[model samples]
Target chain A: MAVLTLAQALNQGLEQALAEHPEVVILGEDVGRTGGVFRITDGLQRRFGPERVVDTPVAESGIVGMAFGMAVGGMRPVVEIQFMGFSYPAFDQIVNHVARIRNRSRHRFTAPMVIRMPYGGGIGAAEHHSESTETIYVHTPGLKVVVPSRPADAKGLLASAVEDPDPVIFLEPIRLYRAVRETVPEDPHTVPIGEASIEREGTDVTLVSYGAMMKETRQAAEVLAERGVSAEVVDLRTLVPLDTDRLLASVEKTGRVVVVHEAPRTLGFGAEVAALVAERALYSLQAPPKRVTGWDTVVPLKKSEQYYLPSVGRIVAAAEETLTA
Target chain B: MLQLLTPSGDVLGEPPLSVDLTRRLYRAMVYVRTFDRKCAALQKQGRLATYAPFEGQEAAQVGSAAPLDPEDWMVASYRDAAAMWMQGYPWELLIAWRTGDERGGRPPEHVSVLPPSITVGGHMLHAVGLAWSARHFGEERIAITYFGDGATSEGDFHEAMNLAAVYGLGVVFFCQNNQYAISMPRTAQTRSETIAEKAIAYGMPGVQVDGNDLFAVFTATAEAIDRARAGDGPTLIEAVTYRLGPHTTSDDPSRYREESEVEQWRRRDPLERVRIFLSERDAWTPEWQERLETEASTEIERAVELAEGMDGLGPARIFEAMFDELPPHLVDQRAEALRSVGQ
Candidate 1:
């Protein structure tokens, strides 16, 4: 086991996939010669001899549509969208074709491809670089959406996403690229796509979140613990095919819940989690499910990004409100 | 021999583009025309749900499709039944799609063709992508993708054309400018004088041919395909044609167009033009022509029976194929569906 950052974990995962599956290929802008904008694909083109690691012609829809065909042709394609904002052009291919191909074909074909994009605000980036739009993917059926906050989870989750025989939208928190470090287990087994993990166990209140929000949620849990309020933290590894059983069981045991995410509040994944708790574990809840999410407005420019992201203070306030309610 | 052979029927040409191929071309067009008419009637009788008839556009489809190698790929829009049929896609598959069976319409990977795209211009991008791969991996196979005048209005059409042109891919953007996109006239569809001219923007060769003229369509398409096979890059061929029938089972053309205009197009009907050309060339004979019509009718009748005899598809098949390997939640959903259906 070797300690690695989120960037290194993702790179190790891509390397492992290349070694394991002959059909596995990588495509993205700057993914070849420059090792990707983040260097996740660094040393890959040289290792795989460029055929398996492709640098596309800066066409988002073209990359996705062709990857869809390649997957149908019995190849496993792991495509990287340079940024979350740049991925919108390929949204039609993702939702209308890639996600619906199997359902529309009545079991004749499937798109077992992975679309990797760095998401969420923070790091003072320009417009379109820091949007947390995971809810949109989670709303779409026939797509598996996964978000990883830690380096170890990034390795395990990405490996699982690449190997899964279904279309997956893997959203990595860009701000956490070098923020967290942990031992990246070589030859680590893939984590199941729809399972959530209990990062910390406590009985007072549950902090439920995924992606970048997991960082704030964990920090808030620590802050609450200093005041003797033991917080239970649940990291939702997969967003679309959510681990409802794990979340409901955790909230039922804690008797309180606070859902957190960086997407806007109106119809984010947090709302879905809140609705699920109200429906499935309402009696066990001592209070209504609370939500800590971005405001219902366009994400402000980099100068105001700190205000846009759900902060540790916000998660703490939401958890305390859940306890009081 | 089939009637309506090309004027060049007597002229000796290359092995694949010879006078003998004229009779085969005419037979295919006539068969597709008859099939289109039968489908219209089926829609009226409610035996088929809806259909986009390709009555006067047989030459454009048959001419372009005739040159494709079995291993070469094709992607088509909704109004491409003639091309799909000529390419040996089973008639039963089209019937299944018309009858609204999800399982019935996907292009067989073995056949190297895609199912008809219902969206206006969506499949063109796929065609460009596949062709790009062929060139990238050193495969010489070409891809032909069909679209309509309405599809030209889509952003996807321009995007696909630009990408194919830049990559020098082996893709033929075949556009059948069939007068009207439902009710909107071609004049209203684009400000440009011709759809082929749009190709010039992408730095690719553009050629315009009479879609009703089998000679012109055959010659132009064969030439474009030759250019593609020789690695000369993408070509845009605009087949100027007209749709003589209603847009679908639901449309009434009288609401949008003049009857006199329809009458004029009817006079220049693709089928009639070929028939006259073949007769003048001495390729027409009464006895053989009658046998061809009888054979086509008998084949369509058998196809209708075969399509109707297939097992009915249920709604649950929709969720089954969404993934190659079912995830855990989907497995649960499959079980739930089974319980609901008492399976």
Candidate 2:
């Protein structure tokens, strides 16, 4: 086993998927020769050749629309959206066509494609570079949304996304690209979509989150431990088709919950999580579930983004609200 | 033979019809005419949902659909039941949809026709996609997609045209320009002089034909299909027809279009033109004319009974056909819905 960063894990995962499935092809801006803007596709072009690792023009709609055709043409396309913000241009194809194809055709046709987008805030980038718009994809019916918090999970989940019969929106946390190092096994296996992982076991309060927010959630859990609060940390791997059973089971064990995410507080994925807890495990809860999230505003540029993104302190405070109640 | 008769309902120059082909074409056209009328009446009586009548457009649909090889795929919009029927979609399926059943017109597997697209320009893109697939898979089958003048306003139309042109895929873009979109006249639809010329922008040949003339519609479409099969890329055919009825039975043409415009188009009515062509040529005798009406009415009655007798579907059907292979979660969701409803 060798230690690899999340970006490196993604590259290895794609390489494996292409080698495994003859139908799988990688296409995106800079993905061919330059190995993607973040270098997540580094060395893939040389390894797979330009035909399989295609570098596309900067037209987001064309890229997505063509991929839709290619998917219908029996190619398992893994299309990369250069950045999360740049993906808005292709949102129409993604939401209207890719997400709804199965339901619209009533299953006459299925889109076995993966749309990869680097998401979430940090790296001191300018506006639109860092935003968690996972909720938008999650809200769309007939789409499977998956995000990985660690290097191994990223590799495993991506392989599964590529193989999934339905189209999958694969969100990669940009902040965590080069942040962590872990051994991503070769001949990597798949992780089931919509399942949550329990990062740390505890009973005092459930500190729930996913993607970039998981970093802060882990930090907050550590701080809570020092303050004599045993926080149970649950990392949601996929937003859509959420592993509600795991979430409810955890919330039931702790009897209290604090959900966090970098996306805006209003109508965020966290709100869905909170609602699920209220509906399934309401009587088991000792106090109301608290939500720690970003302000309901556009993701500001580097200057005030720190203030905009949720922090460990904010999560800890939210968890403490359940404690006090 | 491209067409054995002319639009005035006459046996045309050079080609003498054996009794069989003439009888078939006449019967098909009559059935479509009656079907269009019945749809209008059903909509008026509230027995059927909204309808897109092909009353004056019978020749356009019948002529174009006649020559299609059975294996060739068809992609159509809200109208075009005549073309769809000629391509072998059961007439009962169309009736089911008009009568408010959702499963109506859901394609039978292996029939090669996609369900009718309700959104104006939606299925045009799928047509391009399916054509691309056929070309990639080395399948010789051609895809013929139908849309209207109003569909040109949608972005998907432009995208589809550009894609089909660049790919040189086996696709026929058939635009039935029926003079108006609801109440909005063609003048208000586009700045281009003719819808056919729009094909020039995509670098494809475009042909404008009198949609009321079956011979012209068939000959032009057959030539386009031949070109597409030979790998010459797509052709845009603008069938310049007129809708003789309200946009739907629910619409009142007097509100937006003048009665004079309607009267002028009625004078050029496609059915009458074909009847005249056949009568003047001595092909439509009083005896053959009686048989055509009787045969078409009997066929319509059989389809109506079959559609009315089909089994009723439940909500589970909504979730059932959504995938070729059902995903585990959706299977659970379907089961949950069934249990909740106490089924």
Candidate 3:
């Protein structure tokens, strides 16, 4: 095991996947020489050669559509679309072809591909770069949406995504790329998709979140513990194949729930979690479920970006509301 | 224009394949034409859903697809059923798809054809990707994509061509410029002299052929396919043709086009010219014509029966096919879909 950042873990993970699976090829803009803008794919082109790690033209739809065909043509392609906001150009391809191929061909011709993008705000990045639109993919049928919170999970979940039979939207938390450093296994390992991890153990209330929000959720849990109130933090790694069992168990035990995300409030991922809690665990709930999310507005420019993202104070305040209720 | 046969059934250049292969091509074109007419008739009779007839463009579809190896890939659009069938998509499944059955989209194992792309230009990139995969893996196979002239207006068409040429991907962009995309005439689609000329912008060779002549379309497609297999890079072929029938079952040709124009195309019918070409060479006969029609009738009837006779798409079917394995949420939704129908 070696201590690594989330970005390093992902780079090593992709390197490992390339070394093992000859069919696995990386396609995206600047993925070759530049190693991607954020350096998430850094040093991959040199190690794996330009053939395997392709540097594609700057067309989102072209990158994804070509990747989809490559997947159908019997190669496992992983595409990077730079940022979440830029993914809109290829949204039609993802929704129509990449997601529909498996169903359209009746499992005969499947697009076993992965579309990776660094998402969420608070990086003070330029326009269209800091947008948390993971919910759009979550709402799309046939597309498996996943998010990683830590280094080990990022590496392992990526491994699982590469080998999956269906298309997976691997949403990397941009803010957490170098936010935390931890020791990850050197040998190959996979954190299976579709399962949630309980980051902290408690009983008073459950903090439900995924991706970048996990950091703030964990901080809220610490604050609650120091205040003598126990709080459990639930990190939902896979949003599509959601770990409902773990989510319900945590809610049923605590009986008070607070869902947090950087995306907007209306129909955000938190809405689904909140609705599920109300539907299946209504009776088990001692307090009504609360959602701490960004406002229903365009994620503003980098200026005043702090006002837009879900802050640690906002998460703690929402958790306190659930506790008081 | 690159052509091997004139509009009057006169051989102009060397035949792309042997006479025996030419006979087979004629038989397949006749069969697909019969099937196409039957689908339109069925749609009129309310037996099938809306039908996109490929009557006038038979040579363009069949001829281009005839040269592909079975292992090669084909990404076609809704109006290219003849091309899709030639590439191994079964008649029954194509018919089933027209009848609105998802099961019809599934081709048998070993058929490398994708379900016909309904979107205008979206599927062209799929051909680019298939070609990329083939080249990346050091495979000799190539991908041929079929799209209409109207599909050329879509941004994806540009991207596909540019990327394919840039990467030296083995692919054939076969555009059947059949004079119109629904009510919009081909002249309104683009200002370029011809769809084939657009390939020049992408740094690839482009060839326009008489789409009505089976030998002409076949020869052009064969040359492009050869170039692709030899790793000479992608090529775009524009088959100039006109559709005799309306775009689909719901269309009215008289409202937008001239009847005299349609009559002119009738004289240049792809099937009749081939029949003339074969008959003058003593390969066609009255007895053979009767047998071809009878066999076509039988084949189409059987496919129609198979398509109409399938079991109803129950709740399980609706839920299935989305993913290899159902996630927890889908499992619950499937149960709910079943319960809603009281199953």
Candidate 4:
């Protein structure tokens, strides 16, 4: 085992994938010489050679569309779209082609590829730099959406995403890229695509979140524990093909739930989680499900970003509301 | 600008192809023309859905495809049935696709052709990627993508071109400039004069060919394929032709184009030129034409029957292809679908 940051773990995961599968390749803007704008792919091009780790022209649609064809042509391409905001240019390819190829061809052709983008907001950045748009991918059928909270999960989930037979949209939290370190396993590992991991087990209320927001939710859980309100923290690793079984079990145990996300509250992934709990575990719930989320407006710039994003206090208050009810 | 055969049954110079090869090309054009007419008739009879006819563009499709290795990848739009068929996509599957069956989209594993892309311009990049994959795997295979004049106007066309040129990927951008994109004329589509010239901005060699002449298309595509196989990157071949028919079965050409223009193109028909060339060489006889038509008609009839004979696919089959294994939500949705159908 080795202590590694989320970025390092992701690099290691990509390295392992490249080594294990001859068909696996990595392509993105600045992924070659610059080692990616975030340096997550640092030295990957030198290690894997230019053929496997390619630096494509600045065309998001071509990057994704070409990867889709490569996948069909028997290559497992892991593509990176510099940031979440830049992924929109490739949205048509993702929604229209990547998500539909398998269903359209009736299993004759499949796009076994992964599109990774650094998402969410925390570090001061310009407009269009920080955005939480996982809900759009989650809503599209025939795609698996994955998010990882820790370094170890990032590696394992990325490996799984690369090996999956269907297209996967792997969203990396921009803020969490270098935020934390953990002893990640050196050997190859896979975190299944549709499973949820319970970060902390409590009986009073469930604080559900994933990706960057997990840090705030974890903090909220600690504060609630200090206040004598035991809270369970469920990090939903995959949004699409949601682990409803795990979610319902957690809700049934706690009998109260507060879903949290950095995306806007209206029609966000939080709404899906809240609705799932209401539909399946409503009778077991001691109180109505609550949501702690970013406001239903564009994520603000650096100065007012804190006001727009869900904070630790917001999560704690939501959990407290569930506990009181 | 290259021409081996003129529109009036005369050779421009020494024929680039042998008499036997010219006769074969003529026959293939006749066969595809029969298939195109049959599809149009079927669509009119309500037996098939919207059909994109490639009647005037047969030479561009067949000639470009003739030089391709069977293993080469082909990504084409809705109208290039002739090209796809030449690349080993079965005619039955093509008909089945037009009949709205998903099974039609599933080409045989040996065939490297993708399903016809309904959306314009997006699939060109896919061809680039496939060729890139081939290069990565140390395979000598090349990829070719087919689209029309209107497709060049899409932003994806520029992206695909730049990527292919930058990476030196083995691909051929086969754009059949068939004059109109639905109701929009070629003149209205772009002011660049010719689509081939667009390759200049991307730093790739481009060629303009007489699309109605079979020998020119065959020679140009052959050269392009050789360059790609030699790792010379990609070439953009713009086959300038006219759409003799409507954009599709649902479209009426009279709305935007003059009948006089259509009449002029008819005089330069892709098939008639080849037929004239074959006749001048005494390779086209009445008996031979009769036998070829009978064979092509029978083959098409069988394919249509096969396409129409399959049992309707159910909701279970519809749900099966979405993923290797169904998730809980899809399982629930599939159950609901089954219940609704009284299955």
- Residues B1-343 of candidate 1 have per-residue lDDT tens digits of 1122333333223323444677788888878877888888888889887988888788889988988887777888777888887777777787777776665666565676777778777668777767755765677778889999989998778778877887677888999989999999999999999999998999999988877767777777777788888888889999888898888878999999999998877776776656655666677777768888888888887877777776666645656676666666678888788888898
> Which segments of candidate 4 are over 4 A away from where they belong?
none
Candidate 2 lDDT score at position B32: 89
Candidate 4 per-residue lDDT, tens place, B1-343, comes to 6777788878877888899988888899989999999999999999998898988999999999999999999999999999999999999999999998989999998999999899999999999989988988889899999999999999999999999999899999999999999999889999998899999999999999999999999999999999999999999999989889999998988888899999999999998878877887788988999899999999999999999987657788888888978988999989999999898
Model 4 agreement with the true structure over A224-247: per-residue lDDT tens digits: 999999999999999988999998
Any runs in candidate 1 off by more than 4 Å, and if so which? A18-22, A46-52, B1-19, B107-109, B135-140, B331-343
Q: Report residue B316 deviation for candidate 4 (angstroms).
A: 0.7
CAPRI class assigned to model 3: high
TM-score of chain B of each: 0.92, 0.90, 0.98, 0.98
Instruction: State the lDDT of candidate 2 residue by residue for A1-325, as single tens digits.
Output: 7799989899999999989987778878889899999998889889889868878756566567667756765678899998889888777777877776666555665678899999988788877888788888888777889989899999999998998888899999999899888887877778888789999999999998988788999999999999999999999998877888889999999999999988898899878988888877999999998989888999888887889888899999989889999
Give residue A218's error in model 3 in angstroms: 1.2
What is residue B63's positional error in candidate 1, in angstroms? 1.1
> For candidate 1, what is the TM-score?
0.92
- Screening candidate 3 with a backbone cut-off below 3 angstroms (N, C-alpha, C), the clashing residue pairs are none
Tens-digit lDDT track of model 1 for A87-114: 8888888888788867766556667889
True contacts kept of 1: 0.36
Native contacts conserved, per model:
0.36, 0.19, 0.88, 0.78
Worst 10 residues of 1 chain A by lDDT: A101-110
The local lDDT score (0 to 100) that residue A2 gets in candidate 1 is 92
The residue ranges of model 2 lying beyond 4 angstroms of the native Cα positions read A25-75, A84-97, A123-131, B1-26, B278-282, B321-342
Candidate 1: Cα lDDT at A38: 83
Model 3 residue B306 distance off true place after TM-score fit, in angstroms: 1.3
Clashing residue pairs in candidate 1 (N, C-alpha, C atoms within 3 angstroms): B4-B274, B4-B278
